[model samples]
Structures are given as structure tokens and as C-alpha cells.
Target: MTEHGRPSAPSLFDHAVEEIRATEFRDDLVVREITAPAGVAPFSLAVAADIRPEVDGVDSPYGTGRFILLHDPDEPSAWGGPWRIVCFAQAPLEPEIGTDALLADVAWSWLVDALDSRAAAYHSASGTATKTLSKGFGSLAEEGDGAQIELRASWTPSGSLSPHIEAWAELVCMLGGLPPGSEGIAVLGSHRSTRG
Candidate 1:
């Protein structure tokens, strides 16, 4: 331990956290640090984000997501490196759009595209894209139907961490109905279900 007696954080982990804090997100996206999940690695950092668009002067969020950066000095075999990033992004979808057979594939593509576009590199990348549909019951029949898409992904990261976070933020915005490169524009209509 250092003379100060405080357990020193790994330099790589500290740098990663600093880079994440330095990254700038879209104006409409709200990001904040949250309790990182334990048992994933010796060091971890997590953040939560929401796409909050103004509707009639009220802030309405159409999507939300989480990003976690895990580091292990041992370089776990599955991770292929000391660093692994696990991300989750979910958003409500219009019933019609959700019914499309390609919806799940499209969601996965978005993640890949985001990473490629940012030039974030690594291997052992894997994840799942899930779509959930719900129909209101008797008492809530008037609420109609609803659908939501969720993507869970993890990958070892190489190079700077900035681009990775930015890409994930873009994915969150995309799933919220805002296309990439869209800034200062609010999404039209609400995907949020009246029931929930």
C-alpha cells in the first residue's frame, strides 16, 4: 500500500473511469454513476443513462440503459484481456415495429454498427437481443398492446474507452427512435405505453 494507506486503484481501472467521465454524451441523454454489480471483476464501474425528450415541456424518457466496465488483472480467459465492457440498452417499440421478424436482428446490428463506426476494437464479443410483447388484460384492455426491445452485450475493449461509451450512448439513442447523428432534436411521438 502507498504511504497514504488507502488501497490504490489499478491504474488501468482509474484511467478507464477518468475517460468515461471525460466523454460527452448527447444533450438529451442523462448519464449518472451507479452501484456497479459485484462478482464480475476485481474492479468495476457502472453508469445508467436515459433518453429524456421533452414532450409538451415535460421530460419523457423513451429509453434507458446501463454500461459497466470491468477489469481483472488476471486477464480471464473468456475476456481475452484485463478489460471487459458489459452494456444493456432497452427501449419501448411500437407494436407494429416489434412484430417485424427482423426486429431482433436489427437491434443486434445496431450494436455492431455503433462499435464499428466508433472504431472501438476487441474480440470475444457476444450478446443477445430480446423483444418482449405484452397485451393488456380484461381490466386494462383499453391500454392495448406493448412491446420492448432489450440488448445485453459484453466485449473486451482495446484502445481508448471514450469511443466505446459514446457508441453505447448512440445505441441507446437509436433504440429510443433517434437516429445516429441526431442532436438537439426530440423524438416525435411517444413509444411509452399508456398502461405503464
Candidate 2:
């Protein structure tokens, strides 16, 4: 116990890391924090990643997108919480999928299923899903002219967040938008598909 009375200067980032380690799924994902440098309170947050599947997979040119969670100390009017967990996923899609409503529905399921499967406690989730198609006319290299889908959501972590943390890690893996239970995760079994 230091002068701060609560403990030491472990910082929020350190706490988050310890939380990730104790959650039981940290090894399968890459966890890191992204600090927003221009904000008043220094909007620092962590992300646990599960890369997306590619055409060739092992040698695929681009990576599978991500399901990201964000935490902020400054309470926002909309989220109504000191910390908000945000989720998102972007993956190259066939041109035909650009207009399909299933994209949004499926993306939404990824989050919901993850939460339910992991029995995570959370509330007040809200956000949108967007389909983006690359467009440009320049010699500079750019993302291919393929379609991509992004799903965004924000929520507050409820008490005893161990379940929530496990769910979030699985959610990141799902956001890769690949068939779950592939490489390194098959042994864990596809928990999302077992909903009954």
C-alpha cells in the first residue's frame, strides 16, 4: 500500500493487463492498449485481437479484421458509464455481400453469441454496422476494391467481469468473421455454436 491509499501506481493499463491474464484466454489473442493522445483525460484503452481469415490463410495478403473493446474513464452522455466496452469487426467481403442485411445481423450475432456463451455480464450496448468498399484513383497502394463490413458496439462491464473478459476475447476471435474452431482454437471447442 502506497501513499495513494488504494495501493500503488500500477496504472490502469497494468490493471487491464492483469485482468486479461487472469481471464483464461489471453494467450490466443494479442492484447494491447491504444492511448488517444489528443484527449483531455488521455483516452487510454486496451484491445484483444483475433486476426481475420484470409484467402490463402497462411500466406494471405491481408489480415482478418478485429473485434476491439474500449475503456474510458470519462463518462459519456450516451453510454452513461465511466467505462465503455466497444466492439468492431471488418473483413473483406464479396461484392454481393455489400448490400446484404445478413452482414449486420451476423456481426451482431458475433457479439451477442459471445456474451451469451461466455455468460458475461454487461448492459447498454449500442452501435452500428457499416459496409465499406474501397474507392480511389491513384498510383499509391491502397486496400483492394473489395467490400468490408464493420460492426461497432459499446457497453458497460457489470460486476465480477471475469465472464465478460472471456466473452470479449472470444468476441474478438469471432469478429475475424471466420468459421470458429479453426487453428489454435479447435481444442477450446466452438462455444458460440452450442447455444440451446
Candidate 3:
């Protein structure tokens, strides 16, 4: 314990933090570290990001999300290991796309596909994908209807945390309608574009 009387974070946890700090995400994402939730684990790190395409004159984001990493050296039974990753991703969807009945399943599949594509191994993984539809009320009827999709998931990490984090970032980009490897590619139909 230091002068503050709190137990110092473990060296392994420090290393994990360093790994996260060293990682670089896709250019389209605006990522920043945030305070982790207390009491969830002995050591935790969290990041939040917005999918901001660089289309000229566009200021709003396509979506936003958060990724949290939790580590407990004692190895929590429910997690199956010392490391756990929890993520939340939400994106506005085209009204038509939101009406699809398979949206939830598709969203969940995106996460699975992302992890598999990166070869990130894990178990005890579980999550929920939800689609929400909203219509303007009496005072706001001119606003029209809107829809969104949200994905909340957590999983155990079998090896290095970098891949898992990368996969999560990919999933966020996917939900935001940005195709994989879209870096440096101009986003068509962006607000700045006059194309119908």
C-alpha cells in the first residue's frame, strides 16, 4: 500500500493498461478512455467512442459505443478466467432497416462474426441485441419515426486483450454502417452530400 493506503494495481493489470494505451484504432472512430465502474473488478479500464466519418461539413456521429475491460486475478467463476470484456454499441438505423424482423439476430451475429474473424477465443459469452422504434408524439409529430439498435455483451478473453478490443471496435463500425476496412474511404450519402 502506498501513502494513500489503497492497494496498488497489480503489475499484470498495469501491463494490460499499457497494451490498451499502445493500441491504435481505425481513423473513423473518436476514442477516449473513461473511468471504469467501481466494484466490478479489482482492475478495470474503459473506453468510449463515436463513429465519426470524415465527410466534409458533417458534424454528427453515426453511432456511439463503449468498451470495458475487467480483470480479477482470482478468476471469477462466471467469467471462466481472470479477464472479461463488456461492450455496449448503439446506432441509429434507417427506418426500413429497423423494421426487419431478423435485425436482433443479425446484430448478434455481427458480434460473433467480428470475434471469429479476428480469431479471438473465448467462452461463456452472452449478450442481447435490441431494436427500438420511436414515433414523434403529438407536440413533435413533424419529427417523423425513428429507429435504433443496441447491443450489450460480455465475454471472457482467452489470450491477449488487444484482439478482443479490436473486434469490439470493428463491431461498432459495422453497426454504424461503415464496412470493414473502410478507412480513408469517402462515405457516400453523408449529410454533406447532395446526392439523393
Candidate 4:
């Protein structure tokens, strides 16, 4: 029973469904490919899912990507009956940027901005910031230091999966910092790198 008046993709149970936003997703994100289970942590969110979005970056040597849209159960004991929308973003690390805290701060903002930009209503928003730095060891040799950013988030959804997808789409854009989904990928020179 969402605003669109649809009965909701079968109530996260009746059958497998490809939940979607009015706007289509990027090729990098295969909608039907995502495979998640019913309920993640505790409250049994059952309607959980996942998707991936990628893009060319600016400062880093490599491109960028994000693991968008994960919904799960929040522990009843910890949060008092709330669902968690967990999200993760992975992007190329720019050389010597935001050494102290701005990076994490900006990262969190992406989630908030994503949610706000789409007008996705929800309650009790909270999440964690994680950045991993690991270089190839003796056996696992590599060219240079390996660095990546992971943004994990979970919140209680106020309504249906529609708003969630809208918010999730925004997060994908924020993580990759891509323009509106309408704009196609431009030439390297034309497309300024948004690597952060």
C-alpha cells in the first residue's frame, strides 16, 4: 500500500520481486542480480536487498563504486524495534586527502544528502564510517598501497521500498558523485573526476 497505490512488491514474502524507482538504475547495478536474505540482524527486516554502482573518478588512479541499498533487522534490544538500511560505498582513494576527519564527515553527508535529495522519509537515522588501508604483504605483492572507503549505514524506514530506492539511488550518485542518471558517461576529459 504505497503512495503509487501498488500493493508493495508482494510484501517481502509472496514472491521474489525487483523493486524499482521511477528512474531506471545504471548498468553497473544489476537489479535482479542482487541476492540477500530475509532479515539481517535482529528484528527480522525480511525485505533486505543490495545493488552496486560504479563510475570513473577524478583524483585516484582507478575508478569508483558503491554497494548501495541494504535493509535489515535492527536488534530489538539495541534499538527498540527498528529496521536498518545498511549501505556501503567503495571508491579509489585520492593521494593524501582529508587526513584527519573531513573525509568521513563528507562521507556521512553523502548518505544524508542522498536521503534528503530524494525526499525519502525515515526515522532514527544512524550509521558508521569505515576506511580501510592495506598494502600487499610479502606474499600478496602489489604495485602500491591499497586503499578503499566503505560507508555502512542503517536506518528505520518510514514507509515503503519506493522511498528507499529513491534514497538509495541518491546514495549511489553521491558515492560515485555522478550527475543525474539521465546524463550518460562523457569522455574522460569532459567528465571531471569526482574522486574523494
Model 1 weakest 10-residue run by lDDT: 52-61
What is the C-alpha lDDT profile of model 3 across 67-172, one tens digit per residue?
A: 9999997998999998899999878776767889999999999999999988999999999999887777788676677777899999998877788888888888
lDDT of each: 0.85, 0.53, 0.81, 0.48
In candidate 4, list every pair of residues with a backbone clash. Answer: 39-46, 58-193, 85-155
Q: Rank the candidates by lDDT, best first.
A: 1, 3, 2, 4
Scored against the true structure, residue 44 in model 2 reaches a CA lDDT of 43
Which lDDT tens digits does candidate 1 get at residues 1-196? 4578854558668878999999998788888898999998999999988887444332245888899999998889999998999999988888877788999899989989999998998789999999888899898887799888889999999999998999899988988888866777767447467322
**Clash count for each candidate, listed in order shown:** 0, 1, 0, 3
Best-matching candidate per TM-score? 1
CA lDDT for candidate 3: 0.81
> What TM-score fits each model?
0.89, 0.62, 0.86, 0.60
**Better candidate number, 1 or 3, judged by TM-score:** 1
The residue pairs found clashing in candidate 3 are none
Model 4, residue 119: distance off in Å is 1.5
Better of 1 and 4 by TM-score: 1
State residue 179's C-alpha deviation in candidate 1, in Å.
1.1
